[model samples]
Target: MSVEPLQRSAVAKDEQWNLQHIYATAKQWEDDYRRAGSLIDQVAGYKDRIDSASALLAFLEQEEELGFLYEKLFVYASLKLDEDTRVTEHQARVDRARSLGVKISSATSFFRPYLLSLDKQTLDGYIAQEQGLEYFKKELYDQFKYKPHVLSKDKEEVLSQLGEVISAPKTIFGMINNADIQFGEVTNEQGEKVALTRGMYMRILEGRDRERRREAFKAYYKPYVGLKNTIASTLAASVKNNVLFSRMRGYDSPLHRSLFADDVPVSLYDNLLQTTREHIAPLHRYMAYRKQKLNVDELRLYDLSVPLVDDCEVSIPYEQAYETMLAGLAPLGGEYLDILRKAKTAGWIDVREKQGKRSGAYCWGPYGTHPYVLLNYNDTLDSMFTLAHEMGHALHSYLSDANQPRISAQYKIFVAEVASTVNETLLIRHLLKETTDEPFRRYLLNHFIDTIKGTFFSQVMFAEFEKLVHERAMNGEALTADAFSEIYEALFTAYNGELVALDPEVKYGWSRIPHFYNAFYVYKYATGIASAVSIAGRILEGDEETTKAYMTFLKSGGSEPPLELLRGVGVDLLKPEPIRDLLSLFDDLVRQLEEL
Candidate 1:
């Protein structure tokens, strides 16, 4: 049945996340906003005395406290705006919060440059003398590591002042994609006119009706086709921004600059792309099986998302999904489960889709508060897994916040996906063990295969595309809509092989992906799932020591470098073994599905 999306007011209270946990009222939020602004000014007053140990310690403590309050205010306003983008007041609050954040950045711009002015030995002596400075030892050392990239105080201030303007491309892209682009209606299997949307378009693609799927795919890309030139310009500007920052910072490339932040080796990114390309046969085989199972004359891009076994239905309600996630994550022990239970009832999740709500799911929150998850959930096996995946992030945040100080509580994006993917892996493993039905078991196996294809294969494709575009821009090549489509088409052909028929519209698919605006971000998803596969395999096999190591890694948070943290957990991404093992797992699952 085709139905209109519900209004935000119509959603049940429990189904929505409680933002009052952050601030009970808008007036309270306004008060904190004022307080944060005052603190930013006070912190800036110590600019001349930043070299002193006592002054530095007091400034760091004040900045940390201000950061916590500012984050709470910013998250609440931004989240409320996302809940219903049509609200003007919410939009104003979001703007105010963002503007305040830029001001805060400008106010604190002196800290890094001033700290870099001091020699490492002097900074080390300060850390040893001042007990309070001990808390920010890693942070101070990190600034020293970036000494080469740190600009003069005046230049740094200018750059920091441009933060809001520098972020304009992504802001424009979000408005156009989320609020402006209109996908027209499509006739469904029931012969009713269904309004097509980004979310609805995905559901339509997963339908059994072939014509409807094709219709939705074409309809969804129609606006994108019309706005291709504009989107291309926006994306080009975004890429140019990345190149600009890389040059300004004296890095070899934008990729180098991005990886340098997290201490990830460039070789690791290359290894994933190379390793996945070598193992393309399994992906081709899976495509072949999908074509045969669907019995399509030609496997178009729309056909890729549909289920291989049509009768394998697994619909888990939210309550049941929560219970299943708890059981699946039992290997992490009782204390972890207790935290999950509290998060479940503590209004940490907003669990329904409605009109003008932002599409997709994410876990976000400030350092001092419990992590909040935003989900546009519809009951499906995929949604159940999403619950587990996001909870993985939530628990990770919970543990990190509880263990680390405010300064180091937030983990880097490189290792952030590991926790989330680990939960998904355990949930799938538990499902496979408990299911007795042969067809359903095969379906479970297929789900795992699809996850690899989507998370590992697809993200690597995006990573490669991002790398190519940025490199092209860096090398003085012109980037246009046609140029982007051509690059994307070639990569799609290489990855999909000759088995699947390519659609011309799929070439323009690059414009629709929001992640492109955030350069060098998608590759982490690939590395994350690979790490999870190795870690989950060990836990499922009763490796108690590995399990203990994994738990400790979760608690360590941003206290250590991302690669070093992963090494502590026994998953060394620097080696090719994890990627190879993940490919082997995919091959084994495909064979199992074939046998069933």
Candidate 2:
């Protein structure tokens, strides 16, 4: 069946996210937009006077208010824009929101430097003396922690003014990927010309028909291949920007700067890479098994994603996916499950794909409002898992917002993926236990194996690639399209060995990865699954104390550092044990698959 893309209006109201919850109408959003500008000005007035405890408390409260309002404005415009990228009006709203964000940043640029100028004792006294200042103690301490990197007020203002300019690389990449580039159409096994998209590409790759998979693979990369140089240039600019900013901030490298922000030690990243390399054999074994199971002449790059157990058919609609997710997450207790139910019925999710919508799934919203998830759900088992995954993020946000203050509600990227993957780990465990049929059980087992491969192993590979590219860029190596492809190809070869054939077009795969733009962000996905696997296992074993501790960790949000947060939940990323244990689990799963 050829899939016809729907327009925004064609999507059912229940299927769509209610952005109106943020603002009832466009005029309301506009009103808040203008009001936010005034709030920024109001916040700027207390800049020089924040040295006193009372003034500092007032500043903190006003600042939080301003941030809350700004989030509502920004998320509304962004959610509207993502609903359909082609709409000029929505695009304008996004631009307006972004501009206002820059203005707010520039206006409040003095906060950091001014706060740092005060003595530590004075700041400590303020936190101890003022009731309101207690809420932002962590926020204040983080400023002092980065004191060496804090620039002069004038320089800080200048940097803040350039926020929009610095964001150009990511903006350009989004424009080209979501708006300009096109993948054209491909004929599927149904003998119909179906439109190929980023979302559809994954579905096609999983199809049993090799020819269609091959065709879709080739067509999908066609546009990216043609624009490789342009995309590469944009990516290069992003790296350079990261390097420049890191250098300006007195950091040795971009990796240090990024990790520093989250309070993650460099050793943690190194440990993950080293441990994953040592455990690469199981991944290679899985690849060989995949080839044998498919009975293919050669397992090419495109064949990697095709289903291993072809006879077991599992199709879950959206409503059923919700029910499945709720049941899967019941281990978290009734409170967590109730929140999940509310998220589904409320306007917390935009659940369908339409023309010009952003690809993939994500959870986004400000502190004041509920977290809204954007998913291009395709009704596949994978899509159902995606629903489970994103709901994890939403629930994490929901719980954090309810428990923590506005300043601490937004979790850091380092620990962000844990909640989502924990949901997935539990879901897969539930499915495996619930099913009695042999083939379906095998399918669930294979899914678990594949999840580890994609989430843990593949992410490590990408992290290695990202680390290499950033090092080269920092060392003044020019990053061109060919250079990027060569680096990725070398890493692919080292990781896969002779188990899978590396098609030439697979080298261009680096150009299409959106995470590359975010600079050293992929490694956390590996660490996240590692922690989640351990955490989920404990919950499934009926460890009530562990479950309570995990809930507390989720509610803590950014109140503490990510490392401490994970430690609170009994999964320490600083040591190599979690990674080793996860690898052991992967080995066992691969062995089980072999037996089956």
Candidate 3:
């Protein structure tokens, strides 16, 4: 049943994350906000003086300082706003921080163009002349990779200043999804009408009561279906805006524009989509298996999430869940375990979901501070896995921050999910190995299947959807709610198989995803899992050499190109073997399920 969320003050102090470590009070946050604004104003001081190696070194140093301050300030504002999205005060802070960020971008837009203006020989000479440049050498040399995409200084400045405008679509959607939209209500267990929520929807969808699941399916989509047009507009604006930027940057497509940052090619994106579709038979078989196991004559989209082994739901209290997570992840050794323990006890994690808080879980932190995780924890098995997943990100961040310079500590999104996925893989494997119950063992196996489906199959389907919408927008086709539904439904049927029935709400799946606003990002989840499957397997087999290499990979951070970094740990995305291996295991698991 959906009860009103507790007020922020109602929650115990320790249950909430310690924002005090970032800033003691709102007053201090404002002070840093102002400090960042002042620094943004002075960013123009390094204008033409960056031509010389010594001057460039000085400019880089100042830029790094400003970056450190801006990141911390922005993170605070964003996290504070997430705590209570309805609060206009936090919203104002986020707005001011974003505006200051735009100013910084606009002011420093000249540096890249100037740096690219010099010949490689001259740039190398400058790097050699300045000993301090060693720290920034990789970042500096990496600028040449973007020589083709770098716009003129004037153009770049104008574009940089429009950061707020460019982000408007995402910002509007955030408000709609988090604060404004409501998921109507569903019938509770007692047959009393109760308000529905995202957390409730997740649990109910997986519930054994088919009617409750059906009721929730409609209630959950009630808002999105009702406001389809508005969400469609926001999403369209985001896609078209990406198209505009991609064209302006002279990239082949928006996909290329996004992958360009990590030095990935369009082929990798296309390969993920194609390969997943080709190997989608096992997913179809799993759906059929679900239909058989659940004894439902016709499987519906809502039926997809309910565990095949029904009546296996287990409640894991937060403390119990945390302890279980620690036990599951103990394979990573003591150092990792020590940090994980500290994260739970320290103010690093916001554990419970309350009113107006952000709905999802993620790990984030500013440099020189421990990483923070925001979880709308519902104390379910899924919630426990989420804990493991997000903490994976935290451990990665902690290692990177401690080992690398600030510039490299921020790893790219491509390699970012690997650490998180590895933790999840190891955790699930540990649970499976330790569990003695046969049905729960099968339930765990089902959970792992869902992970592959969600993280790999579903993501690739989304990657394809993203590609199609962008291509449509690129071709000057009209983007509407109906148009999006048509494309989404067809893909849904194609990837999911027609053996299952479709719900009207299924097509509107594109509307609810916050990730679509950030273009071409989900494919990395598919790539990440493929890599993690390999890394986790090796580690599980007592491969110390691989474990050491994996830890080093986490510490390496953004020092090298993401692909090269993955290659060091034996995950080469350019090769299809890893993806193929993952898919083959998935096929084997389905056969095992068939036997069971």
lDDT agreement with native, every candidate: 0.88, 0.87, 0.87
Error of 2 at 571 (Å): 0.8
Model 1 vs. true fold: TM: 0.86
Work out how many backbone clashes candidate 1 has: 0
Pairs of residues at least 3 apart in sequence or in different chains that clash in candidate 3? none
TM-score of 2: 0.84
Candidate 3 C-alpha lDDT tens digits along 136-246: 988987787787787887898788789899999999999999999888778987888999988899999888889899989998888999999999999999999999988
lDDT of residue 155 for candidate 2: 90
Off by over 4 Å in 1: 1-38, 73-103, 119-122, 151-185, 188-196, 223-230, 311-318, 342-362, 365-369, 372-380
Q: Tens digit of lDDT per residue, candidate 1, span 303-413? A: 998878664556677888889899999987888899888887788988878898887899998877788999877767878888998999998998899899877888998
Q: Which tens-of-lDDT digit does each residue in 1-596 have in candidate 2? A: 11466888988887888987888888898888888888888888986676578988887788777788888888888888898888999999889988988988878877877777777887888888988777788788987899888787789879978988999999999899889988978996678997898778898888888888889888888899999999999999999999999999999789999899888888899999998888788888888899998899988888999879864556678898889888888999988988888787788888887899988899998787789999988778888888999999988998999998778887888889999999999999999889788898898888898889888888999999888889999989999999999998988877876877877788988898888888888898899999999999899999998899999988998888889999999998988889988999898888988998
Q: What TM-score number comes out for model 3? A: 0.83
Give candidate 3's whole-model lDDT. Answer: 0.87
**Between which residue pairs do clashes occur in model 2?**
none
lDDT of 2 at 353: 78
> Which residue ranges in model 2 land beyond 4 Å of their true spot?
1-37, 47-51, 73-102, 119-122, 125-131, 152-203, 211-241, 315-320, 341-369, 372-380, 473-486
Q: Give candidate 3 regions above 4 Å deviation.
A: 1-42, 73-110, 116-122, 152-204, 215-245, 311-323, 341-361, 374-380, 471-486, 503-508, 511-514
